[model samples]
Target: MGKGRAPCCDKSKVKRGPWSQDEDFKLISFIHKYGHENWRSLPKQAGLLRCGKSCRLRWINYLRPDVKRGNFTAEEEETIIKLHQSFGNKWSKIASKLPGRTDNEIKNVWHTHLKKRLSSKTNLNVDEAASKGSLNEEENSQESSPNASMSFAGSNISSKDDDAQISQKTFEHILTFSDFTEMLQEVDKPELLEMTFDIDPDIWSFIDGSDSSFQQPENRALQESEEDEVDKWFKHLECELGLEENDNQQQQQQHKQGTEDENSSSLLESYELLIH
Candidate 1:
């Protein structure tokens, strides 16, 4: 929050830069013995020569027992990417899903690692396609029979369709990242130091209305309102297909039941294997 009202102490008086092992031990022991009742009082109470903000950061990011250190696994990386893709610049929100990971750690990994990975993959794909040999009409005809040509044409169309869908998803992800970065800059201002996430539950329920099992009736109403807006094309298609609202409702019920059953069966089998 822009140095938190000039840090309330002289910069030279307080310890700065990376926290040392002794500082960590002192912080952890202090936290365990006295607890973090108040940040301002904590430093003096804990006998640390650091500001309250610095103490809090060191505790949360490093001293906290729950904070996972070391390298992120491939699975964790994938999870982080998917969560970021869904949540945009909500690094704290994404970090909540991943136990033991700090929001700052996740953010750094996204910026330094995941972004480079996606860029490289996109470049590699482009390079590979460019390296492929082009074919003349005669060569194309010679390489494939009429049936095969028809199949190839169909595949080409399908590939084009998938490319369009993928392009849209990629563009949305990029927009999300851009928007989040802009938001991060804005929120880092001095005025809005304290932010609330009380509306997140409401927002998430609205976005993922299809998962009715996880929502309350009040939340479901919000979900339905948003669903009405989000699935406009799907609703139009349903109407064109002459499917009534009741039919669609029944279909959703069946789909949910099938999914639940499959999940239960899978979990039960895993449990049985463990028991055996």
Candidate 2:
């Protein structure tokens, strides 16, 4: 309509319409024989009435041997969605991942199918904004007052506690499953248990496991320090156990008060039982 980039095709003497089957056969035969020498000059050379642009588009979009025309699969649709999410409107790049599917085909599929699917998920798309708003509110609350700072610190500690409790709950749930129970039984079976417990007896007796190796002076000092640490750990364990037993006895001695210490003692006993 607007003189159109100085007319690649001869506007005065070219034909344009739906290509005939004979026309398709001639175009295909010409391309196969001569390999489309020049698409601009192809219409005249090949004795086709269609414009070169139409010929090129037809060859590229439909008549090309490599063009794969079929129904899209579920897997292909999923791949398209993921590709689209990562690179919006990048039809050419998207087409590269999907063999035989042209950029034009990919673009059409996205417009007709994927675009509608995403349009229906507007609420899901806004969830990120909602989460961000919640985070900002938390920050503002934390910055409001001294009391708010203390409350935020308490919340941080509580969150850590919640995470630990949730992890423990999840572990318990997993342990309750039949497969996990079977796995536990397999691990606890006499042979497996013994194999796991039976470490190399001479493991700690070597410096890098070489029989004739002499330890460096620094290594000897470090080993001595570790020995002291082992002795200290044993002493600490004994002290803790003694304190726990004393606390239990005191809770029993003060049964009339029904105090927090008694509850703590009962909880510790339950923990010991569970561990065993």
Candidate 3:
């Protein structure tokens, strides 16, 4: 038969609560002389009335000479937040980037303070977007029944959410791009106003669904109907202009193609100007 899982500790035999100063000393003295290669046996060798798990925690979190005590520095806190972003809930990994800080400590600080700080910033961005979109979002209490002007807090997406969830929820915000607008408005210097847009020259044909490989499912039916009407209109124009079905047919086709290309180019240029 397979060996059963090894027990971590015995609750009845070893100390469970906070480490006393003597407990700390023994754990530290033993680790200082003999490194903690195997934590499961460290406590028994050190002669502490505690489990190896307890000894490990005490040494790592408090008793070690290199462990930083007192409140964390602002820089350290910022580092933890950035590390959390990259590492998710891997506290041990986050702690490694931060010297003298334990995973447990980092985990605690994240839940207690850092989470709300992040959520508040996300909410602020949403509120700013809403204000930019519509004046109806604002409630001037003074204008209605003599009430004071008030704004409600924006809805918050939980930090527990994964990247995909955040992306899906914030897609609407992505389309509006209020943040870019704000950045442009904030620019006071002349050089900052300069901008450029690089795009494919043939994208208009793709939008028209002339490209066999690409068509958006939501607008596929509408595009087909629209294409039919456009074809009819162009044929009508050709007839009204008295184009021959001979050499003049080629010229008519060229004129139609030129008009379509010019319209697409103008549309793109206008979009670029709006962004700038």
Tens-digit per-residue lDDT, 89-184, candidate 1: 898877666655679899999999988976776677766544333313433554454323211111112223453343333222122223433443
* Cα lDDT computed for each candidate against the true fold: 0.49, 0.49, 0.48
Model 2: residue 108 alpha-carbon error in angstroms: 1.0
TM-score of 3: 0.43
Order by lDDT, highest first: 1, 2, 3
| Candidate 3 Cα RMSD (Å) | 27.6
How many clashes does each candidate structure show, in the order listed?
1, 0, 2
Candidate 2: segments with Cα more than 4 A from true spot: 1-5, 123-276
Query: Candidate 2: which pairs clash?
Result: none
Model 1 residue 75 distance off true place after TM-score fit, in angstroms: 0.9
Stretches of model 3 off by over 4 angstroms after superposition: 1-3, 126-276
lDDT of 2 by residue, 73-139 (tens): 4445656787889888988777656644578888988889877865765646768778546645754
